[model samples]
Target: MRVRLDYGKVGLEVEFPDHNTKAVLGLKPTVPLENPTKAIAHALRQPIATPALADIARGRRDACIVLCDITRPVPNRLLLPPILETLHRSGIPKERVTLLIATGTHRPNWGDELEALVGGDIAGSYRVVNHDSKSLSAHRFMGTSPNGVPIWIDKVYTDADLRITVGLIEPHFMAGFSGGRKLIMPGVAAFYTIQRWHCPRFLEHPLATNGSVRGNPVHEEALAIAKCVRPDFIVDVILDEANRTTGVFAGDLEQAWLTGVEFAGKHVRAAITEPVDIVVTTCAGYPLDLTFYQTVKGMVGALPAVKQGGTIIIASECAEGVGSPDFAQALWETSDLEAFVRYISQPDVFVPEEWQVEELAKVVRHAEVICVAGGISAEKLTNCFVTPAESVEEGLRMALAKHGESASIYVIPRGPYVIPTLC
Candidate 1:
């Protein structure tokens, strides 16, 4: 068996003897700076109840829902407990609290993955449920966004005393950075709302689009959307390469995310003063899920990291084909991004999230995305997005050898979902 390990700025490859070429990625877990729970609680000391929690308690905000990105890496174990405790101490009862998994259109986390997050013991105590776009029973139509886009929020938001969310703050290519308002935009916003907000090239500004890596417009818009919901307090975490709780931000999302950006700048941030011609990244393995709807984030996320015509080697082990049954059909059927957006965006299109299906398909237009894994078929790769290679080395070498030192490749070894630029 052959194994490949990507150490940021370094490469480690090892070969093992095995009849089957089974390879599990290598990860060296880092001892959390302090237990995540402890760090979360400590980080909250400065913010939380200061004006932030007070406003939430005043009913100025109607609800309190703790949100975490469903697919990305979040210090849930460390993040969630503190919020519940803080809310509890702040006089917010458990019943008044709702835990929303901001899944966007991604499949709800089930079985072990879900269990592992909240801890087996803590999981049972709360009414922890997932976001279900297809479940009319779980959705409530909020009037519309400032953009005049219709929004369907969870009934919990409309009924609760205050709204709160928990998530990680990281550089996201499309949104600039994650956390803050993002906890709500794609976090809790209805499928239609998300489609509209995502449709606009919201991050066209220099800080958002230019080589400037910070102060992004995409992050601003996502925050604006979150502010629209008026969350009383937000507990945002900053994780390290090992996904451990490196730091925490609790208070106004904008303020907290400003801090998050500062933290992210220190860790995963790379000083790419110049635009790179090629980027090779893994999907981080989750968001792509069984299909491309989740996988497209990688393409969009990688948008900022590469040069205009650079190729992005997207190594995704898509175990399942295009995820949702409806999405898969649309992907295989669409020829290109333009046709995809046109067909799905049509007013007559009945599918609720048709544009999203189209957006995932649109990835084919931006850059050459190469996938490597046993998940989806190779045919799906070449026919739909870019092309697929047999292994990571093959893909990396393909891009590297092509560009040479001039190529300036950013290899996010643990990707398929992680926006290579952000990590």
Candidate 2:
């Protein structure tokens, strides 16, 4: 049997013996919108719980549109132009409108990447900039959320008379789902605010896992912070396995996002007959798999699909390396698994990418992770307590060697995009 996994700009294909493969779980295929542009225009005009976008932009002069960074597959090129045109038609000048890349703690999007993110027309016509989470002077503290997260956001976004966020809604490892309020929390909030919410205590919550937000502290805190900013409008999309927009949610931030979350939950969540001995997954591909930091999501997403003490083989390009300096050092400083946990769990431990390590530790606690990638060195994988393999075949062979030939194998080509929950 052969399965193709998304890798980098292209994709990777793997073949396994018919008897060795159990299933290849992915998002339930959904029909893409016939015309996503038309859908966006329709959504903006008839949105959930809010007036038409033109009405909302009627009297506003300065507008800041927050967009997802490179890690997400938001199809900003298709999504942004219509929104910008709507703003322009409403009399809001393009110069007065700013396109802010909500990169969170990630690096800036520039040049070709920036042009691709918002398209050449939008990128060149408007004032495009990236949010600097570490620039202490750039963030303005908006006071603390009731949930205790200090609400500090990019001054550019807060100062704007009209604040709008555009992103894709999908299952997130820690936040239950991504989009909506997420565009504001880690997206543009100050480093301290992001660090505090991503603190070990919040991430370790049982409800913090995928498809659950009722009691997820990370989701709740982020919503609180978003409320503090009170973005005037939000546009979030739900994509199918093919990265095509399946549904569009626009208008009021909370209502529209919740609507999109409900839509995403139905398609992304999959039921498995039982836990498998060996699980193979990817970090989606391209933009998302560009860094090791993003690779953890694939690990966490596959954790529940693997039996306790079972092996999980993850393949990601990790083209951007570990994606974070502090995360890399944290992994390297620790001697072994025990030290890794002990070091990160320290009372005063506070680092930018520390949450990724904690999430990885949780994955390590439940199952063994083997990484197969050419971009990230084997030494670096070892430092992070993950075994390294040069290819998927080699990794699967290693896993089968330990678990035996009969070990049930489950493959998730899109990784975190599909939630595999054991029945």
Candidate 3:
């Protein structure tokens, strides 16, 4: 059987002998929006649990629109113009509106990428700024949540008379689901705030796993943090396997996003009756897999379907290399897997990107993980307690050799977007 996995800008295809392949997990059949621009406009006009955007922006002077940075597949080009028009129609001048990229701890998005993030026309016409979490001078402390997460957000986001955020709703490894409240917490929050929420304590919580929220502290905290800003509106989209917009949820951040989350659960959750001997997956595709730091999501997603002590082969096109120098340094700090866990388990350890190490540990504890990619060096992969393979085919061959010829294999082409549930 020929299995095609989503890779980089293009795609990767691998042929597996039909005998070993048990299943190919992917998104359930869902219709893509014929005209996403029209759908977005309609959602804005008839919003959930709030007034239409035009009515909300009627008398507001300054407005700040928050957008996810390079990592997300948010279709800003299709979503932004109609929003700008609504602001303009409500008498808010374009000059008073600022487009802020909620970069969190990631590097600033700029130049050509910035243009593509929010169309060239929008970039040229509007004032766009990148959030620098390290800029202590640019943030305002709004006290702390009941759960003790510090609430520090960018002044640009808080000072605006009207605040709007654009994001894509999907299954997130840590937060249960992405978009909505997430665009506020780790999106425009300070480095200190982000570190507090992502601490080892939250990482070890059972409710912190994917496809949940009611009792999940991570989701609850994110919602509380977003309330600090009291954003006026939100525009979150649901995309299919092909990255085409399939649904739009707009209006109140809470209600609209909850609606989207329900919609996402149906399409993303894949039920499996038994565990597989070998699980092969990808980190969605380009932009998502551009860096190894982001590739941890794929490993976590494959966990439910792979048996303990089984093998997991993840292929990513991490063209940007390991992506986080601090994460790489953290790997080098520990001599072995147990030591690495101890280093991250400390409550006071404030290493940047340390959360990645914590999440990677969860997967490593369950099964043997082999990373298949050329961008990350084998030496670096070894230090991180992951074996390295040059190709998915090679990784499969090695895993099958160890597990025997009858080893069952499951493939996840879209990675984190598809949640595997043991039936």
Candidate 4:
């Protein structure tokens, strides 16, 4: 059987034995909204749990709208126009309205990339800016959370008369579901605040994995930080496999987000009768698979569907190579997974990008990982504690050699976009 995996700008097609294949897991297809613009307008007007956006923007002078960075495939062009128009209709002028890119700890997006993020018109006309998490001076101290995580948000967002976040609601590997409060906490949070939140106290928690929100420390900490900022409103959307807006969620932060999460949980989850001996996955292509650091999500997402000693073969474009300098350095220094785990597990030791490595460790501990990343060299992947494969076919051949030809194989084409759960 031939399956086209979400890979790079185009995608990769690999053939697997039909007899050995257990199931091909992916998101349950949903019909796109007939009129996305109308749906978005309706969602903003009759928003869940809170007053309409126009009412919230009424009398407000300055407004700041937060958006996820380029890594997330959010329909910014479609989602922003209606929002800006509503804000303008409610008395907020274009000059007073700022579009803040919630970069989290990632690097800033500029020039053509900036234009691609928000439409060219908005990028040129509006005061669009990137969030710099490393700059302490740029952030306003919002106080500390119950878990002792400091809350420091972008000054531009906090100083605004109206605070809003525009995001895509998807199944996040750590926070259960993405969007809503996430765009506030780690999205525009300060360096120290994000560091504390990504520490083992949250990442190592049992509930921090994908498709889990109740009692999730990561989710709780993010919610706590977002509460401190008191965002006025939010517009989050759910996209289908083609990245078209399927559902629009807008209104009260907690209420609307929970509603979206409930909706996503039902559609994004794929059930398996039992774990398989080998799993093949991807990092969902393009911007998401641009770096090896982001590729870890594909590995972690496939863990639940693979047996303890099974092999996971992940194909990622990683067009931008490894990741941030800090993350690359961490990968180079990590020769032994156990020792690396021990080091990061220490209370005093906290690395800037170790949380991703920590998540990668969870997968390596349970199953062997073989990476098919064209952008990264084999040596670099080996340094990162993963076996590098020239292609998915080569990786499959290697895995089959180890697991036997009769071993059951499960393929997840969209990677983290589909959560594999045991029935």
Candidate 5:
């Protein structure tokens, strides 16, 4: 049988599989909705529109750094050119600009990855670098957080004449959003600040609280400290489901974060309305090693809304394997999370992963993690993390049954990535 087919409405057409197939409609995920680069350019160009890129370029600024979030979905590649171009237009030579990875507590970005971000040419011209948690000199304890906990920061932040930061505003495990305080707190804070924020498990008051460092108080305090150093500009971005920039916020750091948060709210946020028993998710292959560290994002983001001991189904495709070998070996050796934290006595003075490991320990204690991936060994995956049935469907059904078939559920196909879960 032959049939006339038309998908004029969707601008697509395809042959059917059956003798007589039903007319179907579909949408393409890769379809370019709008050019994000142009959108980001427009947004940044809008706010203040004061210090034109050219204005800053002609200046006598000595050094500049471009700090961008490596979390999945942010269109750093798209956002980079216009801003860098602006810098070039302003007269700040490419040689003077340094591109630094703002991984903070997240795993560092490699050289090739850095190039893919800022572009091959820019990546080549400027020195691309990563944050070194191991360097004591890199970190300096300037003062205590507003509540008095000591706040140590990266010294490089002090050296730059023009400092610009990039990040997406999304749901966080503790904070309402992931930008603002994020750029400085874990993004560039020394090991000490990172340890205090993560070790005590202070999600109750996730930073930017009315006041107090005991709360995830690092964000606000960090922001205050950044102001002391005075970042010439900040380019806070908002991403869509594809992680491309839906908006770019320029000017003041807090204001840019607020703008990105509002814009991101439309895409990254899903209100539970009622807590779910089973939340199937993944670590969107980022600081989570595209797979190795990815599971953490799911655990953190889903922790608040998921019922205690509720099952969390995770899917990570970490091709490089889970965590660094040193980290992996350390975890197997120590079942004691606190011991891990206790042994690393001077975090402001010691290893960053030791602090991160402690936080990972806390999450493991609280949740039932079920992983789904192909790159890693099932035995190792099962031993260290929970490797569920081979597929998302199998895992979803199992998770649903564990929570009772009637229990509400959420399926995060993209897995665990950053972007706070705002209420």
Candidate 6:
């Protein structure tokens, strides 16, 4: 059987032996909205829980809208126009509105990248700024969470009279689902705040995995931080495999996001009767697979579908290479996955971007991981403790030889976008 896995700009197609292939998992098909522009307008006018967006914007003088960074495939072009029009109609001028990119600890998007993020027309006309988590002065201390996480948010967002966030709702590896409160916490949060939130205390929690919210420490703390900011509204959307908006959720930050999560969960999740010996996956392609740091999600997402001693072959373009300087350094320094886990588990030791490595540790402990990332040299990937493969076919050949020709195999074309759970 030939399967086209999501990889880089164009997909990678590989042929697998029919006798060994168990199943090829993917998100259940959902129809895209025939008229997304009309849907966006309707969502703003008849929002969930809260009053219409126009009504909410009536008395507010200034508004700050938060957007996910380029890594996430949010439909900013479609979601922003109607929202800006409503805010303008309700008396707020273009000058008073700010579009803040919620970059978190990730680098800022600028120039042509920024234009592509929000569109040339809006980028030229509007006051768009990138969140600088590194600049402590840029953040205002919003007090601390019950769990003792410092709540420092970008003043650009908190200073505005009205706060709103626009995000894409998908199954997040740590926080149950993305969007809503997430656009505030790690989105615009300070580096220190993000460090604490991503520490093993929360990320190590059992409920912190994908498709869970209740009792998830990561989700709980993020919600607490967002509550301090008190965002007046939110616009979250659910997308199909093609990245087309399938559902538009706008209104009360929590309510609308929860509604979208419920709707998204049904489609993004797939169930398997048993675990497989060899699993092949990707980081969902393009912007998401640009760095190995982001590609960790694909590894962790495939964990549930593979046997404990099985092999996982992940294909990510890593077009920009491994990741941030800190992440790359950490990956290079780590000689032993067990030792790395032990060191990071200590309360006093917290390295920047180690959470991703820590998550990778979970996969390493369970199964052998072979990476098919062309951007990174074989030496670098080997130093990071992952077996590097020249191609997915080569990786599969090695795995099949180790597990025998009859090994059950599962392929996840969209990778982390589709959660495969055991029944």
Candidates' TM-scores? 0.77, 0.97, 0.98, 0.99, 0.76, 0.99
The positional error of residue 88 in candidate 6, measured at the CA in angstroms, is 0.8
Where does candidate 4 have its weakest 10-residue lDDT segment?
A: 332-341
Clashing pairs counted in every model: 22, 0, 0, 0, 22, 0
lDDT, model 5, position 58: 61
Question: Which scores higher on lDDT, 3 or 5?
Answer: 3
Each model's lDDT:
0.59, 0.89, 0.89, 0.92, 0.57, 0.92
Q: Over the stretch 152-249, how does candidate 6's per-residue lDDT look in tens digits? A: 99999989998889999998899989999999989999999999999888988989988988899999899988999978999999999999999999
RMSD (Å) per prediction? 6.1, 1.3, 1.1, 0.8, 7.7, 0.9
Tens digit per residue, CA lDDT, model 4, 1-423: 999999998999899999999999999989999999999999999999999999989999899999999999999999899999999999989999999999999989999998889989999999988999999999999888998888889999999999999998998889998999999989999988898899877888888988899999999889988998978998899999999888999998899999999988888999999999999999999889999989999898998999999999999999999999999988787778668878988887987798988888888999999999999999988888899999999999999999998999999999999999898
Which of the predicted structures, 1 or 5, would earn the higher lDDT when compared with the native?
Answer: 1
> Where does model 5 exceed 4 Å of error?
1-35, 48-58, 69-73, 105-107, 139-141, 149-152, 201-218, 285-289, 325-330, 336-366, 385-388, 394-408, 416-423
- Whole-model alpha-carbon lDDT for candidate 3: 0.89
Deviating ranges (above 4 Å) for candidate 3: none
Error of 2 at 32 (Å): 0.6
Give the Å error, residue 294, model 5. 3.5
Report the lDDT of model 6 for residue 375. Answer: 96
* lDDT score of residue 231 within candidate 3: 87
TM-score of 6: 0.99
Residue 221 CA error for candidate 3 (Å)?
Answer: 1.0
